[model samples]
Target: MNIYKHTILLLFINFLGFKTFSYATFSIIAIDLHTNESGAALGTCYTKQFKIYTTKLNINLADYVVLENNGFGIMNLQSDINDFTPIWLSTAKGILAQDEPYYTAKVISKFLTQPNQDYKHKDRQILLLKKDKYNNITSEIYHGENVTNFKAGKIRLHIDDRFSIATAGNYMTNTHAPEIMEKAFIAAEGNLSDKLIAALNSIGLTNDLGDSRCRTSEGVSANYAFLRTFQNGKIKLDLNITTDEEEQEATSLLKEKYEFLQE
Candidate 1:
């Protein structure tokens, strides 16, 4: 079905209350911005209690993009184009009702390429990221150590997206939404519920036949996010990273002049 129709349906179910998960909620309509580079992923999800905005901006998406990477970079969730929606609960304890992201540390993943000389040689004394045509982001993944080297996290990311200026509705609160996270998604049998569940399934998520869970598609997907439990730590990738000596200097330079992640 079209997004407009689906959005209206989602809102109805959210406000009217359905016979599924007791705290079933609806996500805001996400509008895919058509712009430079790859593009930007922008959307707004809200309830009377809170509003959430998502800005998966890619630096390359800028008209005259200037990034710390020196060259250009991409930013987005997936490379392809499609629409998706899914609802899941976070298992975090004790902090519902609060409205903010709470990552214990900055998430890190190995990069496809090391940061630019500006970040490395101190040519540009600032923290920067790159984006794609649509403005998603050339996501800078780093090794876990990379984050430990700094000190921040992602759960907080969820908070930032939900309650930051970058998002819609401007929900400026430093609290958590435990009611939204702790509550299980509503996906039993019914008209709207069934339809919503089916839409989620189409996007790679499958209702867990077992108790207390749902499953998502494996491998990289265009418009879906999944959680994977990795047994092996210390990820091994043939990344062309900066040498230890240079990386230290680069880190020091950045600490002096820039902020990578912001609220």
Candidate 2:
């Protein structure tokens, strides 16, 4: 096997030995077919206090969302975790190999559902997006059966055929959270980056405590949030923000930074 595949195998083996749990509450991945720009944004109730890793892999919630260069694709892994670096790397490699989003997702699903694995596949939520050979944007979203409640996903194409988006959320305060994001994105007026931020902000407006896990304590959806975009083989925008202050909203902070950059 080549180095990439070999490394993925090693990481998978190590994953079986490490036991860790982390939750990524909500996320979206999209591609602007018009401009060949692709990106991902996410918010999670996870905080520094939850980084109880027994190993040296200091992977954060944002690390679960992998973005490829040249607007090739993106991947988001959320819900229960167990050193998903292997899966993340494999997905990236698959994109580089020109594999279809569905094909890559199927491979990942097969691996996660293997009978010998101790980790339950049903506890995970995954999303994948890519451009096919014909330049058509495609998406695949998997909402594991055992993931937290109030979880759902939506894959939509812009009415104008300008873009394609996939969004999903778990442990949300409302079942319509994903739909809210979808509507906001489709109706938002601006560039791809602006639309993405709007989608996230819509959730915050609908319910700052979108991730119900933090509603009782932080009164916000998440402590960590990020938005990243790529275009023309370059990173056009990248924002990763975190807050420890009580009652502070991470998604709000992300929007603040984005607006600051715009100005």
Candidate 3:
């Protein structure tokens, strides 16, 4: 029903066992007008076991928000750490809608327009992204260079009237999450679901040259959510999985499905 309720449910289920897939590396949230739904996706690359766990959520009901990390992104996950960053805390809020097209921009504007004093991050950069109606994605970046006070700028991107996607991640310059997700989104025929799947697949199958530890014993996993409000006031939730042999083994151990089958 509510975002907090959904978050608590996710935590409950995670403690019940989905905790293994909680180590997120990169994430993407997509709102598709064609389908009148929104989905959140994430991917992790771990060297400890050579497995990448990916989960996609299809939301067609109420508004939703999510937080993802690569285990190294935060000191604790329970403290409302919602941004995609290396050892940073930020909240990502989304207005899941079926007909209202400006909902995504509204949420993003709210996030950036306010001075978030709750975050524990300093001397850090801010990244904002928005996809337009013509399928064009625009972005804005704010530098954290300061001499004294912490102040955020009020710059907005030119978001379109059609469907859109917003993605974020924490990594080095060469392995940045936004770049990877954007590439995958464009390559996947500009479809949110396919883009997320492709992004996760790439994260698992390929190694970032900038990440030397990715080949070591550091673990990686990803969790996601999808939400939307239907015209009939009906809510819909769907689950999809993408994985290889190693990921399959890990998910199987958690008693979770790892296939996007035609059912």
Candidate 4:
């Protein structure tokens, strides 16, 4: 009886120890105009079990609607705290949710800007997107310095009827990968699945933590695709993966199942 009791106690301890940790310096979120779907891709260096990491990704999708073409915002978080300041402001109170390492949504249709607002923070980056009813998209990228002021950067793109992509984290690659992905998406004629594979292939070798690239070994990275169809209002998680190899393997495993996510 004592041995059984001890075994139960050990199991309880192990259960508690099975927490997940995911962190990243960079990520990407995109919206395909033709398909009315969205994707949030992340590259980081934190470690955790696969189950825990995937759970976090699903939870993030549950928090906001990714299909709305109105407007959306993505903010990087340093902790698990629930703060929706950027989202609330960007969406103008349309939706609210906790920030994640990689976040994307359709919130409003314009960049949320405040004149003379000096917001500065070393920990976070804010990327906002808005697509109006008229089909005009406004993109705003900012580096958070603190609570009130943010340093804004200009994003140049001529998006026609093609897909749109956004990226954040680390240095260099945060901005670089998105541009490459955008080109690939256009080259693929707006095929998201093909675009993703092309982008990954173009990304080449991923680096560990402290290094910047499309892939990271020290942190958890994910690529999530949100889909919406005229038949089914919302078909979420069309394509999702935690790593490059996972992307390749899952693509093969789900080949017969998910014909939409294949290259």
Better of 3 and 4 by lDDT: 4
The true-versus-predicted C-alpha distance at residue 124 of model 3, in Å, is: 9.5
Write down the worst ten-residue block by lDDT for model 4.
224-233
Q: Which stretches of candidate 3 lie above 4 Å from their native place?
A: 1-24, 45-163, 171-174, 209-215, 218-237, 240-259
Cα lDDT tens digits for candidate 3, 1-263 = 45455555555445545433333334445544455444444433333222232222332111222322211010112111233232112333231111233533444434443445324233333334444344343434333332122222222222244334455444322435455555655566544444545544444444442122333433323322222222122333344333343323221221133233323
RMSD of each: 23.4, 4.9, 10.0, 10.5
What is the full ranking by TM-score, best candidate first?
A: 2, 4, 3, 1
Candidate closest to the true structure, highest TM-score: 2
- Residue-wise lDDT of candidate 1 within 1-263, one digit each (tens)? 23344334444444644312111111111111221111111111112222111122211111111111211222112111111122101111111112233311111112211242112211111111232233333223122222111111111111112110011101112112111221211222322222222222222222221111111221211121111110111111111111122112211222122222111
Per-model TM values vs. the true structure = 0.17, 0.79, 0.47, 0.51
lDDT of 4 by residue, 138-197 (tens): 455555444222122224333565555554444433445545544544565435544544
The worst-scoring run of ten residues by lDDT in candidate 3 lies at 70-79
Judged by lDDT relative to the true structure, which candidate is superior, 1 or 2?
2
Ordering by lDDT: 2, 4, 3, 1
User: Candidate 4's error at 78, in angstroms?
Assistant: 8.9
lDDT of every predicted structure (CA atoms):
0.18, 0.69, 0.35, 0.37
